[model samples]
Target chain A: MNRAHSKTKRTAFVVAAGLAAVTALAACSSSSGNGGGGGDSGPVTISYGVWDDTQGKVMQQIADKFHESNPNITVKVQITPWDQYWTKLKTAATGGAAPDVFWMNESNFATYASGGVLANLSDKLKGSDIDMSNYIDIQTKAYTFDGKVYGIPKDIDSIGLWYNKALFKAAGVAEPTADWTWADMVAAAKKLTDPSKGQYGIVAQSAPQQSYYSTIPQTGGQVISDDKKSSGYDTPEAIKGVQVWVDLVNKDKVSPSLQQMTDTDADTWFTSGKAAMIFEGSWAAAEFKEIPYAAQNANVAPMPKLDQPGGVSNGLGNVMSAKSAHPDAAWKFLQYLGSKEAETAQADAGIVIPAYKGTADGWVKAFPEFNLQVFVDALKNSSQYPSSMNSAAWQDPIELEFNKAWSGDETAAQAAANSAKIMNDALAAEK
Target chain B: MTSQLVPPVEQGQRRPTPLPPRGTKRRSLRHGDRYWAYLLILPTAVGLTVFSIWPAIQTFYFSFTKWGTFGGHEWTGLDNYAQVFHDPELLRSLWNTVIFSVMTLLGIPLSIGLAALLNTKGLRGVGVYRALYFLPVVTMPAAIALVWKLIYNGDTGILNQFLAVFGVDGPHWLSDPATAIYAVGVVSIWSSLGYNMVLFLAGMQSIPGEFYEAASIDGAGPWRQFFRITMPLLTPTTFFVTVITVINALQAFDLVYLMVGKASPAIEESQTVVYLFYAKGILQGDGGYAAAIAFVLLALILLITAFQFRVQKRWVHYE
Candidate 1:
């Protein structure tokens, strides 16, 4: 009887333990915590998140300067890399644990603004001494949604043809002229490539933003329609433009294959003198400056044209986060960043071309040996990277298919069609 | 149910003081045994509840909601699940996963062959060979991916560079879609080979030497002995390894993610189901849909595991 009773008691205990485990498991979904809302007057410690460690240093300097002016506001800088920045920001934003301020990318601005996460800074800008008119109009509009200014333009970067003067001299070719056409570049590339000696002409990349779209206007093609609906990739001009990139590998053999470029990053190839020419953004100038060969041999020129009757250029700019807690401090910081003062500071860094109206003069003086004048000229007409709703959702799928097309696994037409369908569905889903 | 059927048996031989009254004494002893058993399992149970089960439940709940912009979520019913059917990306990823899973299956026989070689009783310096074989398993997957990428480099890779001496130009191992999946799968097999071999070795060691000796005395060959005795008896371990390998292959993301990041030209050919989940959930901010995908993945695994158990009787001979 005693043993039987003990067994029953043990069974009951086992049942109780199983019940507790299930109960605990069921309770896992509930979350607890209060959001750190900004107080009206107390010591406001705002967290600012930005990508680019190089820019982060400049931001910190600006914050330090702001601290000198406004002692009450303390800003904390959070530096997340480009790959993880937007993802981490969105996750943290949804959880209400986001940094008080964050950097905004043109690609991600629409998604965040549409979701009502950003604060309306239109009234703040209009009422304050921070003049929005001081910056370029296109850049100011890139961060605006529904007629409300959600972000302040910080800086601008445009793509330019970076060439090695030594490579040019070695190949018995003249330096890249400002008025060079696409034909001239091809001829230059052929002259530069000496495959027998392990040097290539250029790095042919299928990247839509930096290289492809930069050449689109040259071929009289726009990446997306102005209304931002329907496919721009299937057009004749765009296809012709894209072919220029692909032909360097497939036809001309002047550039390394797509696989080679992907394996060894194009920039690494350029910096190492393995490639003579590369289409890199002004943002890369500082990195180039660090490479010994780049310091002595590299110089910038505006992108070559397609021999079209009339064509121009454009570029993208940096924008500040709208959901910042320290709005006043952010405005002040952005004002300083856009001032000729910050432009001189950034230009001295030798990595970026300052976006302020008269900032190019400072950069020209800073890098006198290099043709920094080309970047300044390019700024007069460079086109912006197209932006639209569901760009991330649309572009990623298209790029995935495009990679297949590049690999010859899928034809360009087939990939384009598939990409269009995918983009359409993704855009429709957002509705 | 098993606990209820099997009555607890405690022998009184070790204890000298035994004489308390029936009802109260039995209850106290039962409580004491229950307390100790609970104490023994407390840590593991707590850990599972805290880590696995809780998160699983949360994932399920999160699946059925629309996320708010700046925190919290509103219930969105089965919309997230409905969206899954419409997601072409998910379909492509699932197809890719199937191909990868089938490719990784080749690792099993390869591991068995390796285990068989190392299990040879008189093999000299077997320990060093085993260590070398097991290196990939212990090394970080990221490091393995990076090193393998360099080795597979089209131009300057050591593999291709070596091939050039023999007048053989190696194909772009990772960049070519036709070869990319196979190349990645090869790395996956290499990484898991050591772990699977170790498990097989442990199972092989547990088998008595007398069986082999007895078979030898009967004039039986190694092949005959392996087929008739060794193979049948190794069923349980084989089942465990197969189940684990299948689950691991299903969840293969890290190697693919580390090797071919989002910007890689080979991403289309190399993406796995979990990689798709990560891209959509974390990268794209579609958490609800991602949660739905997760649950679907979980259900698929459970169904497959159940199917495996159902069919085990056919091939898994229990000695």
Candidate 2:
């Protein structure tokens, strides 16, 4: 009787303990930030959100200038890495508690702009000395939607061939020139590849957007038609452009396998000297410069042209949010950013190739150890990434199949055909 | 007896005894005692409403409306639900989630094995072993995933290097689609093993020693004792663990999201249901569709839980 009573007590104790354990787990998972808003209208508590790790200084300086002009305004710079920035911003936006101003990108700008999340800056910049026309045409167009400008153009980044000077000498190859054609690039990559040493000729992270998207224009293919209803998915030129990277992996054996690339990010691989060359945007210049080896050996050159020239050498532009509460202040901040003063500061920081025409001259002077001039000349032939309604939805499926094609799961022709259908279906659905 | 009957019967009776009723004082005392019991439960009841119940109701309402940027609601009934049904990506994610849950379920038997081992008498360092095993459970998820990611690296990871000794090449565990889900599921299982083991250990410890002592006296082997006595008695703990584990697996998000992000080539094969909802609600700003997906998830969880409860009647040994 005593043993039976103890057993019953033990069972009840275990049940109660388990119940308590489960409840504690639920409480820990659900508890989050208190719904506390920051102080209301004190010192102009502007939270400037940005994604780039290297450009924080340039951004800080811009904020400092804003503070100088309006002594009452206290700007705080918040840096969210590129990957987490968009997701966090969206969460904050839905909560009606987003940062006062956050950096925007072309891919996400249209969605946010149309969703009534951004503050319209058109009227604020109307009679100001900002002179929006002074910025690049494509840069302004990327942020303008429904005849309203939602973002101020901060900077521009176009792709360029960043080569290792040491690798060129080792391969007994001459430095790439202003007029180097596609044939020249392939030959140089072939010479530089050395598998025994765990080195590859080029590091491309196996993305159509990163490696093949811009190259499509070189092969005389448009990414999106004028109507934006049809895509350039199945065009022979586009397929040919994509095959260049695939051949690099399969035929030339100069690029890492899809699995190898997946294991190691392309930027890290290039900076570590595992790959002698890479197609990189000006945005990476800061990161590249920080790598000890790259600082000593790397130099930028314009992207190789086709045999007859005239391919699209396009790039991405930075945008700002439209639903920003501080429209006047944000616009004023953007105007200062667009000014030669801000562009020069950015160049000196080795942050990016300024979109303003003359600003890159200072970039070359500031970073005299590297050849930054090549970036300036490269922009002449550059085109912007396609901006059509539903591009994000369309690109989602297309990019997935393209990756499969590169990994040998599907042939290039089959992948392209399938993606074209997916793209077309998405576009049709949008209509 | 008089205290229980007098209060109710007196209302119908024309007249009570002129003397003080025998049960009146006891009945009033009982009422006061029950009121205090309710007061004791008040804090917990209020907390549940403010936290759990309110959020659940709000999530359901949010599903039927499109959220404005500045935080107002505009209802668009069934539009979000329609979109969720048509989304191939969401469907693929659900399939992946089921696969992950099954893979994680394999950890249950493994935990039982550990529990049985730890339950052994005269085992030295059992406390130390249990604490070491539970290390992953207490560590932050991001830290755990990162360490696992390095170990799973194809070129320089310790796992691949160790495989080289056996004349085998380890596949890219985190990057290869064929093995990525299993690889992540392995981490999930590893991290959760210790917590589950402790529960099992506690349950095994609770079983009366006399049953095992009697079985041994009757010449039963260890396996026989486990099957006949220990297994039967540990059923309640097993039921609770299984329900919690399945629910946890269905809601899997952090490991997949952090280790294999959307831009990853392998993401197509790795995304779970919550990851899909995150993409729609947070990434793509389709809150309505995201909310619809959430409701689908809630329905799935409810149905599965109910099914588990129904099945428990056949197998669960309460005694």
Candidate 3:
């Protein structure tokens, strides 16, 4: 027993020693943020950070292409999961150790730009062949702060109606067309629903972008005022937009219950043949095309309109860090990332719609089986995804209130009014 | 204990009287030895001061401020704490945490029973049974979460399929707000079984076999022997396990965060205190509010520990 005790102690010591060595080695490797400036005559490695793992492969290809042009500069593509990307980036920026170039979302770019964490790219826009008019107006305008461009637009996204052709055929319902209206969607959903067979026409998730964001404007409502000072949830149009799904899930029985949707998301519901229809973004096309069921049965259409053809468009931008050691090298990579060459690579991958104008056709052609062009067309009348200085602060409250409405715990009108109060307070606190 | 003494020999000699007037030079060889020990501990001391102590101080200071974007902050007095006090969700989460701790404490008795069964005399394949029970504790949380998610899924989960044998349909375990916290609690108990049972087994084995033999000769049945002898003897282990389990359960986040997920409808009820802090601090970029939540948890733990110490006197028998 004594010998065994000593043996255990010895083993524990060895393990501790091993862990310390590994930690030291890891720290040494991760502290390599030196290669940012273009002054390095020899080989220099710059970090290019991205969030989506799917799009990272194409970004890596872009890096390779750029390397071919300027062999002295090396771009290392780093992919962090989207959920943790901003949090990790915030910590890195605080430590003065952010990536040389990183992906930025419009909702968050303002906060970082205001904090002086993003580099001003006005000079780059002026000097380079990258024309301001080449990209979508809202996207370019989304990344601008203090009338200066802080980031170059990467990809533009718009919501679309994804429906299963096989399900529609079996139900004897016509597939959704470009001219489908809100009433047409509800009618088709009712006809297609077969609840006794454990199938629903759609899965109405507690999702903002897919459901409320698109439908709100179509019903003629704004999520926030033009000055971004107050909430629009209290408006009759907004309440109608939110009530559309509540009525579908609870009253019409054409959609799954809120609990079921929470257990398995709408995307999974649509993919598994349980749901005939779902509202999804263009970014989902790549994933859906990969799934055999969706690949064969699923196709896209523009989000159904009510009074006018309207949807919500959001985009990602590529920005250089303000504290980058190699600012010139970082800027060069940023230029290449936003160029037609990089956009073509992204389009050919069919993962996302490049924000670059006239390059969306390649994305549509990449997935010829699906009607991917509906997303591009939807962008023509889409509004910017509603954002403020700190979006998550209010987004969380709105979602929480909306969940109650979705769960039938509160009336849509009541939930909308309560959400507006919370949103207004958050907006007031932002300044 | 040693006494400080005046030299009585100084009275016998006048020359010694001058030396007695001054302080005595008492020699302790162990003191010099500890100097070398302090040197040995210097590295650890420095590491703790830099990593642990500094962060604790910062968390306290930041609790009094509002975190601005990009790591900047401004002094905000007690506004964060005021918000924390007024935030209904924070209160709800605290209540949820308390419920989780109490539910998980139920595992203590269940584990003790399993430990006794494993410790049965002449039991065959004891090692195998121990390993089987211990597997969940060793498994990765993410993998365990996925497996449990599949089992708890309402549509096609094996649990509901089993319930269908009785012509019953189980609720959506991880998604339904009514059952999500309890579902997570069940997983928590299953995971904690090994650690608690090991402690109980160690406590049981240390008990003298003669006590059981004596009890048997006095016409005590096996059940009586367990209740009278084993229970009292295992008190210390029970006390230790109880305190540790309470602390561990109060800080519960991983299972709830993984199983219920952020998008689940049950998140409102299923969120543990740490999960709330994570959302506010890490996800929402509100570090000051997060710091305040951390301190509230810290204060709660201190109070519970004090109460446990007071209650422990009634049960734990050190001898």
Candidate 4:
């Protein structure tokens, strides 16, 4: 009787515990639902996602500013680092829980826009005061798909030649100038290279955007056709562009070996005083400012010309999730983020060159040590950063094939031909 | 349901109380008890189904489908599998995984030797030595990979500096295709040695002291005792360690991802199957192909584990 009574009590206790757990779970979900399903008039909070930690602070300030004018709506800033940002965004979008607003890059913009996860802003812009002309042309165009704009231009970046003045002075080589051509740069690189001191003239990284993307166009070649239907790597101009970098490593021996560069990135080499020159983007200006050695000696110059002044330019855009519960709030915040006041604040932060045309002056002045104007000026002659609906598929394989050329195992032409075939196949498969 | 619950309790009670629980009231009590047992297990069972079994089923289903960039997927039958079979990159990664597994497995003997040394009688500061060896096991893999990357740097690395002291020029350990995988494998072995040694120590301590005393009395030296008694007794632990090491090595991704990186010239040679899966699925948005790669890895791991289990009977001694 005692044992039976005890078992009966235990059973009742267990049943009660299970019910409590279920109730707790139910309460949690219901509260979250309430938070997400805020009515049109009630207080609502929307999230804005970005990648860079340096820029995330400025974003928070902008969010605070947006909240001030609209007291009923709150804005939250969320930052995910660059490496995990895309993967997290994809997973969240799949689960219908992506942030209300987030930063978008050109390379991944097509995939996201085509996926229909991004909110179409074209319809919203028709009734709003925001002008598309207010943003950089390339940025606005990059985010447009199927005659609809999906993102607001946030910031723009362009490639430039970053040289260490101290290294040039020590080697008795002339400083890279605006009128410098590819031949002049190469000659100076030869003079700057000193094997005895274990210093290289430059780092010929295999980075597409910073190196070959610019060089390819400079040599009068295209990466992908403007129509995004075919690859131009098989063209003789493309081969010459690749050969320019390859020869620096294997022929002229002016740059660090491909193996050495692979061990340490070009940015590290330049900052550590191991290399004299590196082709870097404007986004690097803030980072270089933080490095004492780079801040003291590094300065930017126009990218050395080949056929013509050439570089690749790209930009970031702010996008809203299609499924955002607070769509009205998100759009308001997005508009505020693209406003001149917010852009001027961003420029003042010195983290990025705001896509708002006149706001970039503050960014240029923020870093007085380096010639930040070169990046803004390069924007005029630079081609758009090449991307397709599925760029990474072709880009990854092309880099692998190019690594062989970089390592001196294959000629540049052979690698370029192989890359062309692979790229074309990938492009064909995209449809 | 009441009848099923009553019988088990009745059987258990029959042995204890001998026909004391024959009434409907007792039967109802037993039924309630069964419900209680189920309720207690309900949370764990739900968790397992949701997190493990359900995902496995979904992944198996996804393996047959082509996924769009967003959420949706369409059935494609065996197309992704066929692509996986033909991919040269997949083949290379598979080969790299095998080489890495073999290299890590080679550390087991070294682990056993260290465990035996630490288990030696009258050893002082055994706790300190054991703690020192176990440090890497607790350290994050990312931290270890980053530190090792700096050490293996070609021009300005501590490893090269140490080598230079001996009048030897070291190859670029991580950048060169010929040396990258082996360099990573060395770090893998070093990091896992502490974990394997601890397991061996536990196995060694469990072996009867009487057996060793008997061996000594039978005119056996230390080496003889080790060969005859310790080696045979250690077989079970060794088998367990080898199986786990192989599984871990085959799943190697984090260290390679951090150390070799996507831009490295050595990446082509050093990347494992899991890394390739990540590159294809997560980085490249080829979910269907990545799922197919994952299933292949699963199949490979199952086959290798089964082979190890089959081979273990020849050497593993339970006694």
* Index of the highest-DockQ prediction: 4
Best by lDDT: 4
- For model 3, report DockQ: 0.19
Scored against the native two-chain complex, candidate 1 gets a DockQ of 0.22
- Worst-scoring 10-residue span by lDDT in model 4 chain A: A25-34
Provide the lDDT at B75 for model 2.
Answer: 93
Which pairs clash in model 4?
A: none
Instruction: Please list the residue runs of candidate 4 whose C-alpha ends up more than 4 Å from where it truly belongs after superposition.
Output: A1-35, B1-41
> What tens-digit string does per-residue lDDT give for candidate 3 at A231-281?
999999999988887898888888988888877778999999999999998
Question: Model 1, which residues run further than 4 Å from truth?
Answer: A1-43, A307-340, A361-369, A408-431, B1-29, B32-51, B61-91, B219-229
Residue A29 in model 1: shift from native, Å?
Answer: 13
Query: Could you arrange the candidates by DockQ from highest to lowest?
Result: 4, 1, 3, 2
In terms of docking quality, how is candidate 2 classified?
incorrect
True contacts kept of 1: 0.24
- Model 1, A282-384: lDDT tens per residue? 6677777778878888998878777452222333343445555566655565555556666567666554565556666665676766776776667667655
Better of 3 and 4 by DockQ: 4
Candidate closer to the true structure by TM-score (higher is better), 1 or 4: 4
Q: In model 3, where do residues sit more than 4 Å from their true spots? A: A1-39, B1-32
Q: Which TM-score does chain B of candidate 2 obtain?
A: 0.87
| lDDT scores in order | 0.71, 0.73, 0.83, 0.85
Q: Is candidate 2 or candidate 3 better by DockQ?
A: 3
